[model samples]
Target: MVQHIRLVGIEASDKQALGYTELAHGIPHIEGEFGDVLRRSHAELIGLCAFIFRRQTPLTTEWLRQADNLLDRKLDELQRLPASHPLDQTGVILPGGNRSSYPLRWAELLGEILHPLLYRYRSELLQAPIEPYFGSYR
Candidate 1:
């Protein structure tokens, strides 16, 4: 079954969370998807905080900055791979839904790049739990 994640309440009201969801849904990996999503989430939180008479608190701003950096890195990595390399490899065959070596490598690198950022982001915000105000529901 497909599980749905939710973050509602005051936090859910943030636009960054929506952005995070969009980025996450774009990832090619089953696991790494959340990193982009979380980054988007943190960004939304920061924006919401800024709007609520808080003009980017140092804490929220820092999180947003980190999230943006992570996203930029992911995008850069995705762009670095040649379109054909991953989609078309020489003398290789795979089962349905399996990617070619080049693309798989690109995907792995993306995982490597995203894992740490995700852990750090989670570590920092997990406690805050923005149930509806800033955190994601999984």
Candidate 2:
């Protein structure tokens, strides 16, 4: 929702998306395939949020800002990775405590980094039939 202008109450049209616009300010654009991936996944997640909203769940901009703060910080760190002359590698772990290699998105990387922090909210938000936003992380 950081990359969008509206969050709710807007009708989708050929010229307009449900709650999106070109005017994104929360996270500055990262160029190249990384930027494309961020934009696409953001669209997907916002669509997912809309689905949740339709199901009577509310997503707040303040929460979005919090999320954006983390993302901005991470991306800023990542951007500095190429400049800081530090050697940090990313290794993906497998299902059974093994390790594997897979090329993926930084947004997903953000999710991985933030998921634990977000899980702390489940106790406050989860009830009845709604599952936690994310199940136990792998």
Candidate 3:
């Protein structure tokens, strides 16, 4: 548990450092099964927008929770699993009574999820302070 938290922090720092480069190159465009790429890019843009607009509001942990929720939702869409499914090293998610300590890739999970959540809730998040102040309210 302790290591997991630290891993998340480390991954976040890396994301902040190489965010722009990642945005330019890491993501790709595709239709149908390529939705995940768009979702992540959207979330990344959300944080970038917030930074440009509100200098004071650090990206909220609420967004992180929402990203985690998004991962859960996506996994659910993939297939049915036990309440606590764990992804293997090769990204194979195993559910049920698999008593294995899941070695999750923090870089992929945290950095990716952060943006997807933000993109999904862009309206709810940006409408109040960002959009309204910028005169782009909807």
Write model 3 residue lDDT over 28-123, tens digit each, in one string: 233355356564454334323233222223345555566677667567543543334433423453565445333344344554555544454443
Q: 1-138 in candidate 2: lDDT tens per residue?
A: 222323333333211223221122212235677555544443223222122222222333334566676657667555654322111234445455644333334334434332232222222221112223434443
Q: Which residue pairs in model 3 clash with each other? A: 43-115
Clashing pairs in 1: 8-132, 11-132, 11-133, 12-132, 16-44, 20-40
Each model's Cα RMSD: 11.8, 15.6, 15.1
TM-score of candidate 2 to 2 decimals:
0.25
Better of 1 and 3 by TM-score: 3
Candidate 2 deviant stretches above 4 angstroms: 1-51, 54-59, 80-126, 130-138
Per-residue CA lDDT of model 1 for 15-67, tens digit only, reads 22211211233333435666565555443222122212123644446556765
TM-score of decoy 3: 0.29
Error of 3 at 29 (Å): 12
- Candidate 1 whole-model C-alpha lDDT, 0 to 1: 0.37
Per-prediction TM-score, please? 0.26, 0.25, 0.29
| Model number with the top TM-score | 3
lDDT of 3: 0.38
Task: Please tell me which model should have the higher lDDT, number 1 or number 2.
Answer: 1
